[model samples]
Target: MPNTNGILGRKLGMTRVYNEFGQASPVTVIEAGPCVVLQKKTVGKEGYNAVQVGFREKKPSRLNKPEVGHFKKSGGTGYYHVREFKVEDPKIYELGQQVNVTEVIKIGDKVDVTGRAKGRGFQGVIKRHGFSGGRATHGSDFQRQPGSIGSSAYPSRVIKGKKMPGHMGTDKQTVKNLIVIDIRVEENILLVKGAVPGAKNGLVSIYIKKA
Candidate 1:
């Protein structure tokens, strides 16, 4: 079994497991596939090489006519999540093939986990952008404000890419080089060391980190 580009999985929250050294390692447990390969794209046709994989199950009624037809062609029921991963060899995969963690990933391997971070909704500069807020003492009325966003008649406008207070979190985040601590093929679970993005049960993409 050669290394695959990536796989789809659900974040099963975090837990701790003891290693052979009797040291406890915090791990984020992911309920990885059983993912079905829905389609394969080639550079000559789609202008890129990629494989579309689906995860989890969804009701037939929940999908539209086109989606229903698409999945049916691949001999699969509706899927809750569907995504594409770029591959070096798309021809190796076929439609309707099931991909589990054990085939591509193993314990001690490094992976890049991608998911949406938890949304912190409308926030101030201090918490959002890590700006140190104003002094709390000494009659400080300017506390907690994003001080001096605009300057006097220079650029005349708030600069682009300025880190200011606004919507926070809920962005696509990728944590790279997380070591795979364990794999349970029976349960289709992968335990990776350290933290990953997204809340519990959120969709996560685990890919073998590129060298």
Candidate 2:
């Protein structure tokens, strides 16, 4: 069976790492994997091949009856995060099998990280879409406002999908082709070059780039 090539993790924080020549590169630290296979789906039965995995064990008391019953099939363990990853075949993975980060991804591999970006509640076009505000000189009443939204002529209404902002961030974002700088197998930590979506401690899904 082919490797799943995906894992669930948490963004620990960002830090810098240096190469042999002492050149620094900013990297985001993620606590990845050690997820357990909760279920498997096959095309013959479930219409596609995939594996459902659970990460970050949770207490049984916090889960509802249905959740507890579902987890019982996987050795009676509860998880805070559960996700599915597509695979070529689901027959190879057994329920409750632990998948470590090192088993699928390696250093220098290109990966895509998916997470929710930090939310910036109700913002103007100047901050959300990077529109240049009016000149900072005195008596410029058109400071941070979004200016005229629409014209009074032909299309007399606001255009669909206009750049005017209502809300910002807190959206699902995927950063693709980030290089894996390092992996700490003992600590289950992965370091990738450049910034990823979301704030510290946010959940992230990392998938190895298909070649």
Candidate 3:
């Protein structure tokens, strides 16, 4: 069974590690929590069950009065990232409590990681959706064009959801069932067997749910 709780973190980067037999394994390194429980929601009061956790210390000047007051209420220094995780029993947790990676994870555990993917800016259908451009040697000038997008009589305008190019990436994505390769409890680092979305240092949430 998967563990219910999770923690917030930053994706450090990727690296490779070799085993005893000289087999190299690629892993993504994540600087996992040390997250603080900022608030708890109860079914009797909030009509739901969840826990709000905060991560990464922020300067007081960086936050306004209301945000400072909120952190103060939770007895935390301050946080730049705050996220909610739904739980079956929120009463077991309390505010101002620290949530570590070890509590919700261990070696060989499978986890789901959620984060924003790296942005690719404006692009053409060739780069965005893998569309093969027109024949290069041909006299046709339609090299990178998306070609025909709509019918002539049936529909006058371009159809919705057509594979035309525009902006790409920077979307929220989830990578599931990534095996926990290693854990550094003191450094709060988690090394997973496969890649997770997002650029280096981007915020990510790691969850262990039933597979």
Candidate 4:
């Protein structure tokens, strides 16, 4: 196991490609790295150590006053997302410096991705919580209802954490140990095998596997 580094990137979308053995692998294309150092944490001051990173530059006019001031103080351009990763031993990155993706991750390493999933509006039990698909024929109208939320007597109360219909997606999620399939230094892109949870173009936090 190694102390993995973090990178900020955009989901460039998903694609399929063939490997050396002529086997196809599904991959999520992410435009990763070339991130700017926004801030750094140390044991003496912050109690714990970590490095904060910023990515995807934007116009100053698009940011609020507080954001603009923070960027100025941190010596960073206007960036869309900022994330911090805990460093166990010691960190050598400095504020206002660049940390390219290549410097941290190598081909075939594992990483964890965190991102906000796409929003799927108000939904029913079947789609939201995986209730069995409804019957199509005749008068069997039990369909997709949550079905008997509570009983008449006995406990008489609906138990907490019971599955029910509600909002779906639009929640933060993490997918762990996704294999790094390919890396392009020039484009700063990462091709990770299997699905990286989230919608296309969502901001994702990529970190090295922690012990």
lDDT tens digits, residue span 119-180, model 2: 99999898899999888778778778788889799689999999997989999999999999
Cα TM-score per model:
0.95, 0.95, 0.94, 0.89
* Model 4: worst 10 consecutive residues (lDDT sum): 1-10
Least well predicted 10-residue stretch by lDDT in candidate 3: 1-10
RMSD of 3: 2.0
Backbone clashes in model 3, listed as residue pairs: none
lDDT for every model? 0.90, 0.93, 0.89, 0.82
Clashes of each: 0, 0, 0, 0
Which candidate's lDDT is highest? 2
- Cα lDDT tens digits, model 4, 71-148, are 996673788878887776446666777888888788888989888889999999898888885686798787766778
Model 1 CA lDDT for position 128: 92
Model 4 compared with the native: what TM-score? 0.89
Ranking by lDDT: 2, 1, 3, 4
Off by over 4 Å in 2: none
Residue-by-residue lDDT tens digits, candidate 1, 156-191: 998998888899989999999999988999999999
Per-residue lDDT over 123-144 for candidate 3, one digit per residue giving the tens place of the 0 to 100 score: 9999999999998875888889
Model 1 residue runs over 4 Å out of place are 1-3
